[model samples]
Target: MNKLVTFIGNGNMALSIAKGLKNNYDIEVVGRNIEKLNKFEEELGVKVQKHLMDNFDISNKTIIFCVKPANVECVSERLEGKARVVFSVLAGTTIKKLRDNLNPEGVVRCMPNLAASVGESMTTLTGDEEYKKEAQELLGAIGPTRWLASEKELDIATALAGSGPAYLALIAEALADGAVKQGLKRDDAMAIMRGLFGGFGKLIQEIHPALLKDGVMSPGGTTAAGYGALEDGNVRSACIDAINKAYKKAVELS
Candidate 1:
């Protein structure tokens, strides 16, 4: 029999993680609303045990804490007992805060983006070394994972991997829009952009991004023209600044 994993919230992040883990583990979701819990199960298309958040005992159960950062205190106060281990996906919430508040035997901070719904999240984790193997096994069900040495490094990674989907979404949207502006049908543009991104995803894994770009660009070709335009717009600088800003925001939230 598969081990049971419990989720402490039923929000988007919770649902996404549950989606990826459904095949590997039995799921139990605790939430404040019955309707939301039911909806979560329905959307997940799998049966799951559901419980109200009030006075829920977490003892001996592995927990995926998915509450809002601001509600950490209120939610922790409601949980009745110590969890065996807690893997938190709350952005900017510190392991010390989780340990102090929830009194879990082990605390791990995880940063997984929306891709978790499709088992492709670039999850990053840091916390108690004791739970390293367990964390890898659980979160790895969703996608590739990188276990960092320090909370500081994890926070920076959070800014990159955790918040990366939104950045890529913006770029993807802009690319499709640019193609549409050049007279391609909107649907065709979107399809082509998605295909381009899909292929790039594989190529990037095998080669440096600069090498990938160079391989595509020839002297005064269309690719070079487009690449030069992107450079002229300072897209690289903007991306660097975005990472810096996001990292600072994560630190501020802690």
Candidate 2:
């Protein structure tokens, strides 16, 4: 590609996006320190042009804006030159804030999970009307993307898809722990848990969660018994609360 995509940070989020787009674009990274930038390159296994924030030039460069929401203002003060376009992955940060602070020609607010590192993220994006399609296609290089009509909608998606992987990982680990507590070998329990999640990942795409659960939970069986236990333990309520709390946090951050 002729255009260089300059990532504005060297953290996990930046690394993940860079990993997905490395083959398709010319990559350059900007960070505060040379050692961290070199570490990023080593981890990414792609030698990219690097620049310090004080010396980096943003004019006309496409930016993968990956700084934390809390640090956005401080980072914005350090940046100079007009960015051609910026695709930001800061959850709870708005396009208006980005424009007022970073002063990009166009800003696309996005929420992409860590799964981007493995090319399986569910990225949600919303931005300037003209850049909507371009943003989708660019993020689609890593995984499928959904373009939302409004920032509020994108905020809800962030609470769900952006925070989803961590929730799922907790369940996976807990499931393995359950097996280990029930006398299964730790290694075997972990292996089985991973396999179960992998298979369920494929199955869920085809069947609704409720329908799939109903199909497995025959009357008076092991599945039913376990389901009953989960119900009694208020698992569903806890999950609902998780989403509510996360969504509230997103709103508060905004």
Poorly placed runs, candidate 1 (over 4 Å)? none
Q: What is the lDDT of residue 73 in candidate 1?
A: 98
Clashing residue pairs for model 1: none
Q: lDDT of each prediction vs. the true structure? A: 0.93, 0.90
Q: Can you write out model 1's per-residue Cα lDDT over 1-254, one digit (the tens) per residue?
A: 12899999999999988888898799999999999999999999999999999999999899999999999999998889888999999999999999999999899999999899888999999999999988989999889999999989988998899888899999999999999998999999999999999999999999998898889999999999999999999999999999999999999999
lDDT for each residue of candidate 2 in 1-254, tens digit (9 for 90 to 100): 23578999999989988888888888999999999999999999978998999846688888889988998999888888999899999989988899999898999998999889899999999999888888887898879899999998988888789999999999899889998999999999999998999999999999999999999988899999988888999999998989888988898898
List TM-scores for all candidates, in order: 0.97, 0.96
TM-score of 2: 0.96
- Lowest lDDT block of 10, candidate 2: 1-10
Off by over 4 Å in 2: none
lDDT of 2: 0.90
RMSD of each: 1.3, 1.3
Query: How far in Å is the alpha carbon of 47 misplaced in model 2?
Result: 2.0
Cα lDDT, model 2, residue 241:
89
| Residue 192 lDDT in candidate 2 | 92
